[model samples]
Target: MAESVKAPKTVKVASTAGSAAGSGAAKAASKKKVKGGVINVAVMTLAAGLIATMAIPAYAFNPQGADAAQFKASAIDGMKKAQSQSVEVPETVAASAVARDAASATTEEQLAAAKAAEAARQRAAVSLASYASSYSGPSVSDFLANPPYPNFSLDQVFSVAQQYIGTPYVFGGSTPAGFDCSGYIMFVYAQFGISLPHSVSGQAALGKRISIEDAVPGDVVIMPGHDGFYAGNGNIMDAPDTGRSISIRPIWTSNYYIVRLGI
Candidate 1:
């Protein structure tokens, strides 16, 4: 019985030892398998890196080439050739441009001159209208037919002249409506058939000179460039000048003489 127990115990110990050995072998085999898998993964990663490197284009590393450099040089040469070239205009075209500018300037000058002439014409028309408007009274023919004075005496002539005392002074008037210095005398004498020129100097020559002391109210008073009716005591009655009416005023100057018409 002791031998049998001892034998069984020995068998159990051998079985336990076999089981531990089998477990250790399995662990070693698993470690070897894991190490082999790691190595395979490393080798695969190296192969993939090599494939990626080989896939890239060779030109990506070195961009500039002979063809690109030649193209850039050709473009620069074309630009320089275009800039250096000179464009010439035709002589006829240049002449035509000059003539066009000259014609434009001449046309402007003519238009300005025409406008100035038109303005001058308008001003003359207005002045003529004003001159026409001043005369609305009797004409020289009316006074000639029906003489206001029965006798052609100096006092009678002056009395006939007094009827138109308020007439306006016109530059070249002779009617009752308006009168200048000499026109007043002419109009007054025209009624008496005493034809006198409508000029101060002409009228002065027609009359006989008289001393101022012997002068009467109807005598003609002659000055250097003017004439009027002598209104005794150094007074005169006549149409004076522009913007003035026929009026009576003291003789303004001493360089004057008295004259009697139809003397």
Candidate 2:
């Protein structure tokens, strides 16, 4: 803060003329000295007013919230901070964008897998169609003599069966190139619009029971954990197991039961 300056005091001095009624010259000298004292007081009052104007703060009279320089600096700093923030992204927002990209990639992969599965199903249908009409075998009427059912031909079973004659046995596989015993059975029957579960015991329960003594073509010959399609003359076309070929071979066991696939 600026220091308060004190104004010098103006003192009035008496004339010391020779006497009160001395002469006219003496009175004139007294009046001249009085005017000089008044002039000195005026000069001193003006100087004091000038000093007070320079020393007093503007806030002491009409105050303001902020000075111009301080306000300008604050504004400039705020603008610089905003500019720096505009070019950067928050970590949370960046992570959300990456998550969306990963989700999109996973959806595309699932779509591709679905398309491949559909394509495989269509090719299997085509292969079955090519063999459907090639076999000429006993009709369903032969094995289902006592039942009142339609006489559907069994040729389709044998036709589809023959196509996989040399296909290697593959555990849990049902494709034409390879199959397990029950897998082979289910694959062939599927062409004739039969749905079978991929299990040996499951296959044994799917058809009408027939004694091996009265068995005919299209009968299911089920053993302990194996099964095959009954070819006429006691032959069976089947995928034996892993590391074997599907073939029309003789019934290898009498410890078996027969089940006719359809009436």
Candidate 3:
């Protein structure tokens, strides 16, 4: 009598269907959580991309290009201010920079000019020193300064030569106030428009070469005793040798000659 128990087939089928529905609900919930995790990752990625976009501009404008970055920032600020106030900014800023550059250039040019002037002064001093060294020794106007006679005329020069009778003898004198042997002759004849050599032997070689026999009143007379203008009285006035004054002396050497100073 105890073995007659039987289960309902519809009730068993309903329990299996109910278990399957519960499993499906659990799978759906897991899929939704996974999808939500993916969405959060994508949001983080978007946020990171946005941060990179902003940081790249900041890195490019770092210390290496600080001046240019500051200028750009100022320009943007200026433009913004200008837009707010309806004014101009580019021309005023550009003009200020140009003025500063011009002032710096002018100062540099002034310094260069001063240096050039100093260089020119040094060159002028050197040239003047060179000129003083080339002309040395007594001049040739000694004998012509004082003629021995009152009747001597410079031949062909059409002029009477007489000056400096008692001038003191000096070592290198060329003035009427004092006379050197060659310098006295040089000083006297220069007043009469005569260009004579500064040396004794050199003066005797001027004009047409002539012998003592052809000597005249205005003839240049040379002798070993001394050179002078020959007076008809046979005496000559000459700035004599060192420690001696100009005097008239007889021509005694074989080196005596007469030189015509002009044609």
Highest TM-score: give the candidate number. Answer: 1
Model 2 poorest 10 in a row by lDDT: 140-149
Give model 3's TM-score versus the native structure.
0.37
Candidate 3 per-residue lDDT, tens place, 35-119, comes to 9999999999999999987765432656687656655655456457667855567987989999988877757668899898777
Q: Positional deviation of 254 in candidate 2, in angstroms? A: 1.4
Clashing pairs in 1: none
lDDT of 3 at 16: 94
lDDT of 1 by residue, 1-263 (tens): 45543467868889999999999999999999999999999999999999998865443354665446444545447457668967799999999999999877757779899998787666545544676776675566776777665477877887888888998777677876567899889988888877789899999999999899999988999999899999888999988976678989999998999889965
Q: Over the stretch 32-139, how does candidate 2's per-residue lDDT look in tens digits?
A: 999999999999999999999876643334356345534444544745765784468899999999998987775777989999878766655554454344434432
TM-score of each: 0.49, 0.42, 0.37
Q: Which stretches of candidate 2 lie above 4 Å from their native place?
A: 1-152
Following a full C-alpha superposition, what root-mean-square deviation does model 1 have from the true structure? Answer: 21.7
Q: Using alpha carbons, what is the TM-score of model 2?
A: 0.42
Instruction: Output the TM-score of candidate 1.
Output: 0.49
RMSD, candidate 2, Å: 19.1
Q: Order the candidates by lDDT, highest first.
A: 1, 2, 3
